[model samples]
Target: MEKKCINCSQRFNCRDSYISWLFFIIGLIAAIAIRSVTFLMELGDIYAKIAWYLGVGGFFIFFVYKFRINHRRSRFIKANKLMEKVSGRLELKERDYEWIGSLLCSLSAKKERINYFVIFGLSALALVIAIYMDFVR
Candidate 1:
């Protein structure tokens, strides 16, 4: 009852997938916390509001970028290791690695953009709620 590499049929412990899943959960929690903080904080001054919005937005962007990079790097390493084990060959050229890395980076950027939009949308909704609570009451 041993797990084999999908690429080369070599036997190896399949723990990378589990680790990636763990990281995914942690990333989700971080994202949620970032969103929640921005949603809950009330800024009375215009300058303070501006600073808070920028700070939270910047933090979310940074976290998402780093998270995506780390996640992709871990997956790439795991994939390469599995391929080496199965193929009995380690013929990965620098260009091959670069290509995969770039592809993953671009995909990660796209995902980050989507997340940014969602955060922005949520913030707008929260603003509307705050306004309603302050004036419409």
Candidate 2:
């Protein structure tokens, strides 16, 4: 599918859309692991231990992915010389604009909306459950 760059009006196919599921799962695991810790702890020590493990594992995976993406973005910035150019001057050239537009386009992911929605929903549910478990019990 061709997506238009909002800044440059250039049409390009987003290749990473399919890979966003991996991001969604990682985020889901991390969110669930974090919110479930206290609730799981109330259940039993073994369950609390399991939740801790899941939380730690999810954090590790999330950070690794974050670092990798940051490194890739750093490389892109270095290769494009965007930092130096922007720091030295206020006006960006046509090529710089195109590159920035491409970067923005690449950073935009369609699945992020749904991912955030699901995460927020899960968090709300977890909060309600926590409240019920703590005070309503």
Candidate 3:
């Protein structure tokens, strides 16, 4: 909500976060297309094998990094919203606001506990996808 905190001088923007999300989607799409093409190509050929490793492996790394960046950016944006609300109630100085924002952001960033059933469900879906894509072709 607040672009900049007057007390802490910390700034937050959604533009970077949105950009990271966009890149993540685009990267995922490109990776899937590359994998599909590779699957269709002759596995005996060396070039196709190289493409398989590079395309899929590079995409996996890129996806993880971008996901982390987006996660942190989301936390930063949440912290800004918190600073906006709490600043009105406290007569704190710059350092105090900074400390409060950091503390709140850290607390907010922790993920809720995930059920093992959900994990199992997603894994099952992934297995189905792999079976269909590889064998049903």
Candidate 4:
């Protein structure tokens, strides 16, 4: 179980999201190391190559699938941090945190969700541009 960001309208990490990410990283490292070892040894094992590709691909897919949930958590964390400075002035109690956050969510649902989508879309676009520049240049 992982602790969710208090500001999130949706409660997350009912499961082990962070641990899943850790496993994803670990799996990626292990897969790379194994592939490197096998390729360097000139094993020429087709099955080993296939296994490595599938493992890495699966980890990547899982990461993409979980990215949205993680993004929400990040949004919540950022909002909460900003609020922390103003928390005292706002007279917000520990419990009032979620109530106020939820109120904002209801009042500006489109704006908040759109903001997140815009940020994500820009980042993905940047990644694509970077990959193209690196590979096509």
Best by TM-score: 2
Q: Write the per-residue lDDT of candidate 2 for residues 22-73, one digit (tens) a residue.
A: 8668877877787787789788989978877886788688778767877998
User: Cα lDDT for residue 30, model 2?
Assistant: 77
* Alpha-carbon runs more than 4 Å astray in model 1: 1-108
For each of the candidates, the C-alpha root-mean-square deviation to the true structure, in angstroms, is: 9.5, 3.8, 9.5, 12.5
Candidate 2: segments with Cα more than 4 A from true spot: 1-12, 17-20, 86-95
Model 1 lDDT per residue over 1-137, tens place: 86633321121332335544454444444444444443345544554456556555656756675677679777876766745643776677765655455544445443456566766776677577767767886
Residue-wise C-alpha lDDT for candidate 3, range 5-84, written one tens digit per residue: 33222434212356545555555544554444434464446665665666577568666775786697668657566556
lDDT score for candidate 3 against the true structure: 0.53
lDDT (Cα, 0-100) at 29 in candidate 4:
48
Q: Cα deviation in Å at residue 61, candidate 1?
A: 12
TM-score of 2: 0.68
Global CA lDDT of candidate 2, please? Answer: 0.75
Q: By how many angstroms RMSD does model 4 differ from the true structure?
A: 12.5
lDDT of 4: 0.53
Q: Quote the lDDT for 57 in model 4.
A: 72
Error of 3 at 44 (Å): 3.3
CA shift of 97, model 3, Å: 18
TM-score of candidate 3 against the unseen true structure: 0.34
